[model samples]
Structure formats: structure tokens, C-alpha cells
Target chain A: MNAFLNQLPIGLSIGAVLLLVALGLTFTFGQMGVVNMAHGEFLMAGAYTAYMLQSWAGRQAVLVALPVAFFVAGLMGLVLERTLIRRFYGRPLDTLLLTWGVSLILQQVARDLFGAPNVQVKAPTWLVGGAEWSGIRMPYARMFILALAVVCVVAIWFYLARTKQGRRMQAVMQNRELAACSGIATSRVDQRTFFIGSGLAGVAGVGLTLIGPVGPALGTYYIVDAFLVVVAGGLGQLRGAVLAAFVLGLLNSYVEYWSDASLAKVVVFAVIIGFLQIRPQGLFVLRSRKLT
Target chain B: MRRLREAADAVASAAVRWRGPVVFVAVALLLLVAAPAALSPFRLELLAKYLCFAIAALGIGLAWGKGGMLTLGQGVFFGLGGYAMAMHLKLAEAGPGQLPDFMVWSGVETLPAVWEPFRQPWFALLMVVVLPGVTAFLLGLLVFGRRVRGAYFAILTQALAAAFVIWLVGQQGLTGGTNGLTNFTSFFGLDLADENDQRVLYSVVAVVLGLLYLAFRQVVASRFGRLLVAVRDGEDRVRFLGYDPALVKTVAFTLSAISAGIAGALFVPVVGIISPALLGVVPSLEFVFAVAVGGRYTLAGAVLGAVLLNYGKTTFSEHYANGWLYLQGTLFIAVMAYAPKGVIGVAGQVRDFVAARRGRAAPAVVPPARVEEGAAA
Candidate 1:
């Protein structure tokens, strides 16, 4: 029971990280239909942003890093949306290829700017240690991330359900033509949604720094799994991303406990493939009338 | 009889189409000689390596360009074929059932059951074609049968490739693990290190690629080819016309996988290595990249894309080791945005421009390929 408790935190922490990353992805990729392969690189950019701020501000950087990473990565996302992604709005494959190209460039640029090797950031003093009880210990970093993820998910849910802007975004997502007819500024909403989505990814990247070293390839590593989260969660559904992330993350952690990391990955993939076979529409799906 | 006359006319039209083949064969023969005479041995080998990629690209042209499956997991097939060939070579070198060195090192005293069959050259050669083919058949049956396609299919395949790499890396006892199988000395009684043999291998691959190119050209021009394109453009319409879109896609995908597998088998001997790194998501993406760069709409474009981009990579990496990726990345973005159809499409545009300036009748400019909507994963 004690060892299970020890293992549970690790699984939950990984799940938390995935949930944060997937939260960003679920909006831009899932709702808006933007196939941003560079989404992961945006995460990497956030990590690097956190890294840069850490050097400048020292131990106190963690507190400021989340919002800073959000704005920095969000601004980059906004710039990308306006300059490149806007042109390929309806063209998903082209967006995928173009964004992938952007991802490649971003990765190379990160390597050029920060050097190729992994760089470590010091955890804030507040998040340095762990909570322990009867030989079972959970790291403060993991605990903080879990709480942060829950808060973010709840905040996003509230924004979607209660806020005027969020409703407009949902309106645009559901029926763009109808939304445009009803005087909703669809493009502006797209821009803002992309900004917030990318900002969330940046936040996730900062969250990542609490546990491990930051590198250029960090985003690339998580992007696919995040995509899996989005896909398995069903398109344009936040709860699905949360549910999928937690399931995959927990499964991966438990598998990793039994075998090496590589085998664990294989098992996770196998499980996903099997799951997808059974439920092609994914775990959750929203329905709408189709006059076509 | 009317049927006999129609058959005769069919043969006649096919003969007329032979004009394209004449030019193709001429190009092949020219390349066949020019490769050995113009380039040094090392460069010739590198060209051979590129030709292997071109073979895979040809498959992409058939599957993606014409059939429109957007397969992003050709590397799995390629890896299967390469590993099959590499295992054969490794086992052959291990001599009459002594077991591979790595397996021994990993504490296996005898050859595993799966590795035992690979000891035979013929079985390995057969497997190079069969392994990827069967795998693709099974995968296509499962995925396409369920109507899974487009970006979802692309992502599924990408994940599969990643999973394949991880599986290979984890199974140290079976595979060579992450380090992979290397240190090959010979293949089929010929010394791999010999310059003459290297040229021989290069010529052999070049000829095979040329043959495959011709084969695919005909396949694309045939009536079945039209059906494949129809399936791509409209599945429901094709179903109304009494063709199963899923089966058509499966055939195309399976063919693509087999071609990638053949390329992999060739790659093992020319490159002298097979590893999980070459079979990962990145390499699979690069396969698609080569297709995109070459102009996925045309056969020659696919081959050209593979050769040129790969050559550029080797040259760029060699010359500017530190930051060549930046240039490559920029080039990819520029090409994707400005010339999404790649060099052939660009040339087509320029030709139209010249004709327009001269006030002559411009040939119809081909529009860029369309990406299907709602397939966004």
C-alpha cells in the first residue's frame, strides 16, 4: 500500500504535465482545426523562456515564469497565426506540413540559441522538497503541478461555460458561417484563442521545468503524446483531453515501473492502438445537426 | 470482331505511351554509365543510397500523390526490410549457427527461433519483400477497413513508427538494441569494401529504381489508376460507381509499404547499417518530406526530391556542420509556402509565364493538390 502510494504520485505528476500540454493543444488543434506540429516546439520555447528568465532573476524566476512563458509563447503563437497559419486556415494538410516545417526551424533555432545539450534550472525553494507520511513520500514539485493542472482545467471550464468571449469562441468553433452571420468577429476570436492555447502550452512548459532538464527537443517529445491525448479525448473536448491524459499518463507510469522506459512506451502505444480500434470516434464526441 | 479491334487499339495506345518509356529508358541508360565515370567511388555509393530513398519516394508518389492516403509510416516497412536483410548478413557472418555476437553478449547461448530462419539468404531476401507487405496488408485492413484516414491515418502511422523504434530499442536480446546491427563485411559472396563491387551495387540499385519508376508510371496511367484518383477525390461517388474505396486504399498502401521495404533491403547493403534511429518518426517524416519536395503529383518529382534533398543534406551537413539544419529548415518552409508543389510545379508555372509573355497559347497550368477537409486530426 505504501509503495503504491509512492508510485501513484509519479503517475499523477506525469498525467498533470500531459494535461497541461494537452489543454493548450485541445483548443488550437482540436477546436480551431489548426494542425500545429510546432505546438511541441512552442512548449520547448516556453521551457527556454523559463530558462532565460531563471538566469536573469535567479531563484524567484519560477513565480514569474508561468505568466512570462505564457505571454512569450502566446505572442509567438499570435505572430505565427497572423503571418503563416491564417493563410492555411481550411487547409489542414498544408498547415500540418507548414507547421512541421516551422517546428523543424524552431528546433534548430533553439539549438543554435541555447546550445544542443540539455540545460537544468534550479527549482524554487518553495517547491524543492516533498510531503512524506510513513515512508511514502511525494515531491512538492509533483503536488504543485497536480494542483496547478486541476486549477487550470477548472478555470478553462469556467471560461468556456461562463465567459462571453468563451461563448463567442465556442460559437465560432461550432458554426463559423453562422457565427460570422451573427456579427461575431471570427478572425479576432481565432487569434485570441490561438494566443491563449499557445500560452497554456507555455505554462505547461514552465511546469515541465519543475521536474526535469529543458532542451530544444522537449516540445517534440511531448507533442505526439499530446496529440494522442487530443485525438483520444475526441475533437474539441477539454474533459476528454484531461481524461485521456490521465489514463495514458498513469498507464505509462505503471508500465515504466515494471519495465524500462522504451518497453513502457511500446506498451502504451499498443494500448492506444487497441483503444482507438474499439472507439474510433474517441472517448467523447459532441453532436450537431448536419443539413448537408 | 469488335472486341478484337478494341484490344488492338488498346495495344496501339499502349505502344504510343511507350514514347514516355523511351525517354525514361534513355535517361536510365545515360545515368547507368555516367554514375560510374563521373563520380568517385564514395560519391557513387552515396548516390546509390539516395536511389534507395527514391524507390521509397516512388511508392509515396503512387500512394500519396495518386491514391491520397497520406501514409506517414513508410519507415516501419523500410525498417522491417532493412532489419531483415541486416539480420541475414549478421547471421551469415556468425557462421553455421554460432549465434550472433550481440545475442551471445546479452547471454543467449543459442540462436533464437525467429533469428534461425534469417540465416538463409533466400529467406531473408523473400522476407525483405514479404515482411513489409504482410504488415501493411494487416495494418491497412484494420485501419482503412474502419474508415480511418487523412491526418488521423497520418498520426496513427507516425505513432506506429515511434512505437516500432521503441520496441526495437527495448528488445536488446532480439534486435541489436539501439546501437543496431553493423560491421558487415560481405553480401552474397561479394566483398562490400571493394570499389568495383560498390559500383556494381550502385548500378544494380539504379537499374532497379529505373524499372520501378517505369512500373509505377504505367500503374498510374492505367484504368485502375483513374479509379484510385477517383477514390481520393470522392469516396462516396466511387462507392456509387461500385468500387470499395477501402480496398483500393489498402492495395495502394500495401504497395507503398512493399516498395519502402525493398528500398530498406537495398539500404542495408549500400549504407552497411540498420538501426531504430532510421525507422523512427523523424525518418518517416523525412520520407514524406522527400515526396513533398519532389512534387508528390509526379513520379519524376518524387525521385528528384529524394535525390536532391538527401544530397543537399549530406553536402550541407558536411560543409556547415554546426548550423546546416537552420538552412534546411528555412528551405523546407520556403518550399512549402512558395512552391508547395515543389520544383516541377514551379517549372510548370515558369513555362506558362514564358508562353504568356510571348502571346502564344499557354499550356494549362496544373493547380496544386488539395488537402481534404475534416481529416484534421
Candidate 2:
């Protein structure tokens, strides 16, 4: 029980990070139908952006680093979308290749600027330690991330359900032709979608710094996981993505307890393959006439 | 009168086609054939490794370029075949009834059940081809059977490649655990290190690649090729025409898997190594990059893409290992964003432009040779 308790923080922390990344991917896929393989690279960019800010402003302002990372990475994402991704809107494969190239470029840039070795981020003093709850000790950093993720997910859900722009985005996702016909600017939706997705990736990058060392290949590792989460959930379905992330999170955490991490990945993949075989449209695929 | 005109047009096109592409292939062949003599033994070996990569890229071209199945997981098939061949080579070196050095080092008293079949070279070779084909066959039957196309298929394949790498890395006792099957020697009693023997190995691989290319050319020119394109372009329409999209895709995917497996089998002997580094998700994506940059829909393009990009990687990394990835990434972006049809497609456009300026009728762009006959434009 104690051993299990000790491991929960790491698992949940990673899960929170995964959720943020997947949510970004979910938004993009939902709105633009682009896989954005470079989504993880965006996270890496954000992490680096945060690190750079910390160096300039010092570690005392790590909280301020959060919004700064979001702005920098989001701007990069906007540039990527307007310049490269927008041209290949309906062409999923081309977008995948192009973004992958972007990812490689971003990683190499980091390697050049930060060197090939891991760059460490000093955690804020307030969120450095852990507190015991129900005989289980969870780190404050992790709790901060978990709380942030919950708040983000809920906030996005409310915005999507209630706000005018959010509804327009949802409308565009549901039926682009119909949305356009009804005076919704699908192009604006695309821009907003890119911003939200990239912003979420930046947030996730900040969350990641709480636990792991920020490195060049950090995006390579998480991008695949995000893809798995998006696919295993339904493409473009936020709720589905959240659910899938949690399920995968719990499954991986428990599996890591008994097996080597590598083996756990294999088992998870096998399970996903099997699950996909059973539910090819994914666990929470939305029912729409346009799905075909 | 129409028949005479058609015959003249065909003859004229064929003659024009032979001028540029034939010259290119001839020059490429001369370069490849003369490379061992001109270059040092080490460079000769590195070039051999690139050819092995070309073999894998050929499959990607056929599957992605022609068949329209974005098989991002060719690495899994490549790794399966590589590990199989590596196992046999390892067993042969270990001699009768002895476990491979890594297994013994890892404290396995006896050979694992999975590694047992590899002791027989014939069985190992067969499995190298069969295993990947069967896996792809089953997977395609399931995924395509459910009509999972586009990004869904791509993600699934990538996940499988990642899973394969993880599995190989984790199985320390069985697989040598991430260090992968290395330090191999003595292929079927020949000295692998001998300069002459290495040359012979390269030539043999060259011949095999040539024959495989011809075989692929023949396969793509058949009726089946048309069906694959039909399915890729419009699956519903293909179904309306009485062709089963699932079956067509499965066959193409299986053939591609076998091709990748054969490449892996050759890679082990020619490259003298098979590690997770070569068959991981990164390598898989890199292979896809080669195909895309080379022009996935063209046969010569696939082969050329694989060879050129790999050479570029070696040269770039040798010079700038730390920052060269940016160049590679930039190349990918440029190729896709600027030339979706790839190098061959660009060449075709240039040819058309020259012909147009010369006040002659521009030759029709030759469809990629890897597509089945009816699918050819």
C-alpha cells in the first residue's frame, strides 16, 4: 500500500501532462483535422521558452513563466498554421509529414541552443514538496498540475458549451459547410483552434517541468502518447480525450508497478491494438452523418 | 488511321523517355558499381547500408506512393525481419546446442522457445519474410477490414512500431535488451570482415535489389495494381465496381511487409548490425521522410530517395551531428510544402517546361512504376 502510494504522484503528474497535450491535439484534430505530429515539439518549445524566461527573470517568477510559455509557443503554432498547415487543411498525410519536419527542426534548434544534454528547470519553492493525504504522500508539484488540468478541462468545457465563439468553433467542427452557410467564419475558427491547441501544449510543457528534466527529445516521447490518446478517444472529442487519458493513465501507472517500463509500453500497445480492433471508431466517437 | 497515330505516339514517347531517365539510371549504376573500387572499405560498407535502406524505402513507395496506405510502421516489419536474420546468424556463430553470447550473459540457462526456430537458417529466412507478411496481413485484414483509412491508419502503424521497439528493448534475456543483436561474425562460414567477401556481399545485395525492383515493377503492372489505385482514390467507387477494398489493401500491405522483411534480412549481412536504433519509431518516421522527399508514388524515386537521404544523413551527421537534424527537418518541410509529388514529380514538371519552350508537345508524366498496370496513367 505504501509503495503504491509513493508511486501515485509520478503517475498522476505524468497523466496531467498527458491530458494537457492530448487536449491540445484533440482541439486541433476536432477543428482542423490536422494530426500536428509537431504538437510535442510545441511543448518542447514552450518548456524551453519557460526555461529561457526563468534564466532571465530568475526562478522566483516561475508562475509568470506559465503564461509567457503559452504566448511564445502559441505564436509559433500560429506561424506554423498560417505558413504551412493551412495549405494542407484537408490533406492529413501531408500535414503529418510537414509537422514532423517542423518537429525535427524544433528539436534540432533546441539541441543547438541548449546542447544535446538535458536542461534542468528549478521547481518553484511553493510547489517543490509533497503533503500526505489518506496515508498517501503526493507531491505539491503534481497536485498543482492535477488541479490545473482539471480547471483547464472544465473551463474549456464551459466555454465550448456556453460562449459564442466556442459554439461557433463547435459548429464549425460539427459541420463546416453548414457552419459556413450559417455565417460562421470557419477560417477564424481554425485560427482560434490553433491558438487553443498550441496554448494547451505550452501549458502541458510547463506541467512537465514540475517532474521531468526538459530535453530536446521530450516532444518525441509524449507526441506518440498524445496520438494514442487522441485516437483511442475519438478524434476531436474533448471528453473522449480526457476519458481516454485517465484510463490510459491508470492502466500505465498500475502496469509500471509490476513490470519494467518498456514492457509496460508493449502491453499498453497490445491492449490498444486489441481495443481498436474492437472499436475502430474509438471509445467515444461522436455520431454524425458527416463522419463517413 | 487512329491505330497508326497511336503507335507513332507510343514510339515517340518511349524514345523520349529513354533519353533522360535512362541516362540517370546508367550514371547511378556506374557510380554504385564503381564505388567499392574508388572508396575505402569503410565507405564501401556504409554505402552498402544505404542500399539496404533503399530496399525498405521501395516498400514504402509502393505502399504509400502507389497503394495509398500510409504504413508508418514499416520499422516493426523491418525489425522483425532484422531480428530474425540476426538470430540465425547469432545461432550459427554460437555453434550446435550453445546459446548466443547475450543470452548466456543475461543468465538464461537454455535457449528461449521463441529463439529456437532461428537455429535453422532456412526456417529463419522463411520466418523473416513470412512473419512480417503474416502480421501485416492480419493487421490489414482488421484495420482495413474496418475501413480505417488516413490518419487513423498512420497513427496505428506508428504506435505498433513504438510498441515493437519497446518490446525488443524490454526482453533483455531474449533480445539482448536494447543493445540489440550486434557484434555478429561469420555469415554461413564466410569471413564477414574479409574485404573481398564484403565486396561480394555488396554485389549480391545489389543484384537482389535489382531483381526485387524488377519484380515490383512487374507486380505493379498487373491488374491488381489498378485495383489498389482504385481503392486508394475512391474506396466506395471501387466497391461499387465489385472490387473488395479490404482484400486489395491487404495484399498490397502484405507484399510491402515482405519487401521490408527482405530488406531487413539483407541489412543484417550487409550492415553487420541490427539494433533498436535502426528499427525504432524514429527510424520508421525517417523512412517515411525518405519516401515523401523522394516521391512516394515513384519506383525509381523511392529507391533514389532512400539512397540519397541516407547518404545525406551520414554526410550531415558526420559533419554536424549536433545540429544537422535541423537541415533534415527543413528538407522534409520543403519537400512536402513545396513539392507534394516529390522529386520525380518535380522532374516531370521541369521536363514539361523544357518541352513546352522547345515548341514540341510535352510528354505525358509517366505514372509511378510501382502501381499495378491498369493503375498506370
Candidate 3:
């Protein structure tokens, strides 16, 4: 019972980070229809952003890094969107290969800049402690991240659902020609959507620092998992991303607990494959007239 | 004089018709004869390894190029083939029902029953072809049958590869852990250590690649090939015309898996290692990388792309290890941006341009879209 209770925070924190990453993917991939294989590199860039800020700002780096990472990564995303990704909007496979190239370059650059070894971010003093009950213990950092993830998920959900810019983004996603005809600036919407999505990835990177090791390939680890989140969640649906991320995270936690870490990953993949086989459109599909 | 002129014309047409097969045979002879005579033992082995990759590339051309399925997880099948062969070799090295060394160290007292079947060469050989074929067929049936196409399919395959690598790394005892199966001594009673046997192995690989290439050419020329292209361009139109796009896709995917599997099985003996690192999403992408660079639509382009890029990678990595990744990355981006059609496609464009410039009217070949138009029509 105690172990199970202890597992909850770990699972929730993992779910939170996944949700944050997947939210970004949902926008860039789900909403915008860009494959963006280099999306994971944004996460790596965000983590490195926090790591750099930490050296200059001390423990308060977490506070300073969050917004800074978001903007920095967001700016990069905007540049990439404007120069390259926009050109290949009609070409997903090419976009996939191109973004992967970007990811490789980013990883190699990170390795050169930060060195090949994994970089650990110093946790804030506030998050150093934990809550203990009987033989079980849950760290404050995980709890903090869980809370942050919830806040971010809610914020994104509200933004996408309520904001005018969000509606424009949604309109473009649904029908780019139709949206443009209706007087929506589709290109502007695309730029903003790409920026916001990448910004969220940066934010997720900041959260990642608290939970795991920060390295050049940090994004690589989560990128596929993030893709799975979108795939399982259903394309272009924020609520689905949230629900699916949590399910996958909890499933990952429980499975890892039952077996070795490597097996857990395999099991997760197997489950996703099985799930995809059963529900090819995912758990929550859009009610479009499109044929399956 | 008229009869002699007529006979000369017949011979000219015959030569033109036989050019493709003649070139193919010449390449095969070059690989089998000229290679060993020209290259050292070390270079021969490297060429063999590249040929294995070429085998995988050929399959990618068939599937991704022809059927329009971007199979990013071929490394899974390749690994499956490698591991199957590696298991047999490990058992052969161990000599009759003995637990492999790693298994013993990991406290596995007995050889796992699952691995026992691979002890036979016939069984292992069958598995190299059958395993990946079955896996691909099932996966294709599910995904393609359900109408999963384009990037969605690519992402799914990539995820499977990532998962597969993780799984292989985790099951260290069964899979020889991260070190993979090494120190292979014999292959089907032939001493692998002998230099002559090594040449034979290279010859066998060359012959297999040649046969695979020939087989792929026949498939590409057949009626099924046009159907595949039709489906790739517009799946819905084909479906409405009463053809099953899913079945066509599944067959192409399965053919690709078999090729990848065969490459993998050959790779173990030639390369002597089959680690999970070699079978990840990156490596799988490398398979696609060869196809993309070669001209995915052309079988010959696939073979050339695999050989040239792999040789480039080998030499580049050997001299300046770190620079290789940068080059590879740059190439990936450049290829996608500038050369979406790849080398062969570029050549076709050039030919068309030259013909037009020379004032010879040529049929305009419609430029293929970066993405398939799909069932939208």
C-alpha cells in the first residue's frame, strides 16, 4: 500500500512532463501538420538554457530559466518555421527528414558546447526535501513538477479553447484554404502556432531538469514518447494529449516497477503498438467526415 | 546490301534492349571478381558490409519509393535477422547445448529453449527470411489495412524501432546484452577464420545482392509496379477502382522486411557484431538515408546510394570520426531541401533539360509531389 502511494507522485510527475512535451507536439504536429523530427532538440535546447542560466543565476536559475528557455527556443522555432518548415508544409516525410537533420546538428552542437557527458541541473533549495509516510517517500520536486504540469496543461487548454489566436490556429489546421478565405492570416497563425508549441517544449525542458539528467540527447529520449502521446491522444486534440500522456506515464511507471527499466520501455512500445492496432485513430478522434 | 543493313539494324536494337541486363551482370562480376582482385581483405569485408546495407536500401526503394510507405523501422527486421544468425553462431561456438558465456555469467544455468531452435543452420536461415516477413506482414496488415499512411506510419515505425532497441538492450542475457554476439568462429561447418572461406562469404553476399537487385527490377517492371505507383499517388482512386491498396502496401512492406532481414543475417557473419545500437531509429533512418540519396524510385539508385554513402561513412568515420555525423546531418537536410527526388531524379531532370535545350521536344514528366495527394481527390 505504501509503495503504491509512493508511486503516485513519480507517475504524476512523469505524466506532467510528458503532457507538457506532448502539448507542444500536439500544436506543431497535430494542429500544424508538420512532422518536426527535431522537436526533441528544442527540449534539449531548453534544458541547456536552464543549465546555462543556473551557472549565472545560482539556484534561482529555475525561475529565470523557465521564461528564458521558452522565448529562446520559441525564437529558434520561429526562425526555422519561417525559413524552412513553411516551405515543406505540404511534405511531411521530407519535413521529417529535414527536422531530423536539424536535431542531429543540435545534438552535435550541444555535445561540443556542453561536452559529451550528461549535465545535471542543481535543484532549487525548496525542492530538496520530501514527504514521508511509513516506508514510502515522495520528493518535493516531483510534486512541484506535477503541479506545474497541471498548471501548464490547463493554461494551454484555456488558450486553445478560448483565445482568438487559438481559434485562428484551429481554423488553419482544419482547412488552410478555407481559413485563408475566411480572412484568417494562415501564415501568421502558423508562425504563432510553431512558436508557442516550441515554447511549451522549452518549458517542458525546464521541468525535465528537476526529474532527470539533462544532456544533449535529452530530447531524443522524450521525443518518441511525445510522438506516442500525440498518436495515442488523437491528432489535433489538446484534451486527448493530456489524457493520453497521463495514461502512458502511469503505465510506464507501473510497468517499470514490475520489471527492469529496459523491459519497461519495450512493454510500453508493445502496448502502444497493440493499442494502435486496435484503435488506429487513437482514443479520442476528431469527428470529421474524413474516411478512416 | 539491303539484307545486311536490316541485320545490322536488328543487332543495334538487340544491344540497346540488353544494355540493362548486361550492365547488371558487369556490376555483379565487378563485385565478385574485380573487388577481391583490387581490394585488400579489410576493404573486401567493408564492401561486404556495405553490400548488406545496400540490400536493405533496395527494400526501402521498393516500399518507400514504390508503395509510398516510409518504413523507418527496417533496422528492427535487420536486427531480427542479425540476432537470429548470431544466436546460431553463438550456439555453434558453444558446441552442443552449452549456455553461451554471457548467459553463464548472468547466472542463466541453461540455454533458453527459444534459442535452441536456432542451433540448426536451416532453421536459422529460414528465420532470417520468415521472421521479419511475418512481423512486417502483421504490422502492415494492421496499420495499412486501417488506412494509416504518410508521416503517421513513419512515426509509428520509428517508435517501434526505439522500443526494439530498448528491449534488446534490456534482455542482455538473451541478446548478449549491449556487446551483442561476437567471436563467431564457424559458419555451416566452414571455418570462418580461414581467408579463403572469408572470400567465399564475400562472394555469397555479392551473389545474394545481385539476385535481390535482379528480383526487385522484375517486380518494379511488372503490372503490380504501376498499381503501387497509382496507390502511392492516390490511394482512394485505386480503392474506388476496386483494387485493395492495403494489400498492395502490405506486400511491398513485407518484401522490404525480408530484404532487411536477409541483409541483417548476412551482416552478422560479415561485420561480426549485432548490437542494439546498430538497430535503433537512427540506423533505420540510415537505411532510408541511403534510399533517399540514391533516388528512392530507382532500384539501381538504391544500390548505388547504399554503396557510395556507406563507403563515404566508413572512410569519413575512420579518418575524422566526429565530422561524419555533421556531414550526414547536413546531407539529410540538404537532400530534403534541394534534392527531394535524389540523384536519379536529378539526373532525369537534367536529361529532360538538355533535351529541351537541344530543341528536341520531349514529353513533360510531371514533377512528383513532396507529399502524396492522398484520397483527397
Cα TM-score per model: 0.94, 0.92, 0.95
- Candidate 1 lDDT over B1-377, as tens digits, reads 99999999999999888967687777787679877899999899899999999999999988988887778789999999999999999999989958878888889777778999998889999999999999999888887776766677777788788888988998898998998888888888768999998888888899889888888888888888888888877766787888888898898898899999999999999999999999888899898888888898888999999999999899988988866667766777777787877876788778778999999999876555555643643
Query: What are the Cα lDDT values of the candidates?
Result: 0.85, 0.82, 0.86
Clashes per candidate (backbone, < 3 Å):
0, 3, 0
Candidate 1: which docking quality band?
medium
lDDT (tens digit, per residue) of candidate 2 on A230-260: 8888777778888888778877887888887
lDDT of 2 by residue, B92-145 (tens): 999899999998889999898998888998999899999999999998998888
lDDT of 3 by residue, A1-292 (tens): 7667767766777788788888888889988778887789898888889999987899978779999999988998999899889888777877888898888888899888999899889999999989886757778988877887888878887887899988788888877889999999888999999999998889888888987889888988888889989888888888888888998888888888877778777777778777877777678877766555
List pairs with backbone clashes in candidate 1. Answer: none
After superposition, candidate 1 runs with Cα above 4 Å error: A1-6, A289-292, B1-19, B353-366
Interface RMSD of candidate number 1: 2.7
Q: What is the C-alpha local distance difference test score of candidate 2? A: 0.82
TM-score of chain A, every prediction, order shown:
0.95, 0.94, 0.95
Better of 2 and 3 by DockQ: 3
Give me the runs in candidate 2 sitting further than 4 Å from their true place: A1-12, A56-60, B1-33, B352-377
